[model samples]
Target: MIRAFRNEDSEAVVALWLEASLQAHAFVGKGYWESKVEDMRTLYLPLSEIVVDADEATGEITGFAALVEDFLAALFVAPRHQGKGTGTRLLKLAQKMRGTLELSVYAENERAVEFYRKHGFKVVGQGVEEATGHLELTMRFGG
Candidate 1:
């Protein structure tokens, strides 16, 4: 089940991010993955909104997603939980709270791009991130 993030969930959430980042690193590079995690705390955590997916049986966090205003800031699912729809469910919850949403994603991460697109996100613009020297695409959802 997906629920609002509690302070207690930080450790699990961070772990999920690290795991997802490691998977992303295979294609995006380790430096880019590291910068993404750094951006999570620096750019998203301060915004004070996140949601976590918990395993019903174990109660262990399986994934997490966060939002800042109308922007979807972070969305990571544990490697073991991928393709199980947890990320999409969390995103739908975020969208329910904010009718519109936007997010920046690394352009090199095609799987993520396709995932977002499958969930109705559309690329609206592109830019370079100074911190990671990676190209980013800005995608938006809703009207």
Candidate 2:
């Protein structure tokens, strides 16, 4: 089930992060997972418009998605739970409320780039994020 993130779910959310981050960055160099975890925690913690997906049976956090105004900030699903429509559901939820949606995705993350494109976002700008040296692709949803 999808719901708001609660304090009780912090550790599970972290676990979801570690699991999904490892899978997503497996081809990257070593220590990438740790650095990403730290970066993500700091980036999303203070955001008020965040939603977490929980596995109804286990009550474990299976994924998470967040919206910062018109920007869809972060959407992640655990490796095991991916390809099961969770990400799409979250994306649709974000679209229902935001007219001019936007997001910054890592240039190297082709999976996410394709996903966003399939959902109608187009690359409108690009730059390197100084803090992480990650190439960022800025995408927009509105015409």
Q: Pick the candidate with the highest TM-score.
A: 1
lDDT for predicted candidate 1 compared with the true structure: 0.83
Off by over 4 Å in 1: 31-43
RMSD (Cα, Å) for all candidates, in order, is 2.1, 2.1
TM-score of each: 0.88, 0.85
lDDT string, candidate 1, 1-143, tens digits = 88888877876777688888889646657666666676565566667588889998999998887887788888888999899888888888888889899999989999999999998999999999886778999999998
User: What lDDT tens digits, residue by residue, belong to model 2 across residues 71-103?
Assistant: 887778989889999988878777776878999
In angstroms, give how far residue 30 of model 2 lies from its true place.
4.5
Question: Model 2: runs farther than 4 Å from truth?
Answer: 27-32, 36-43
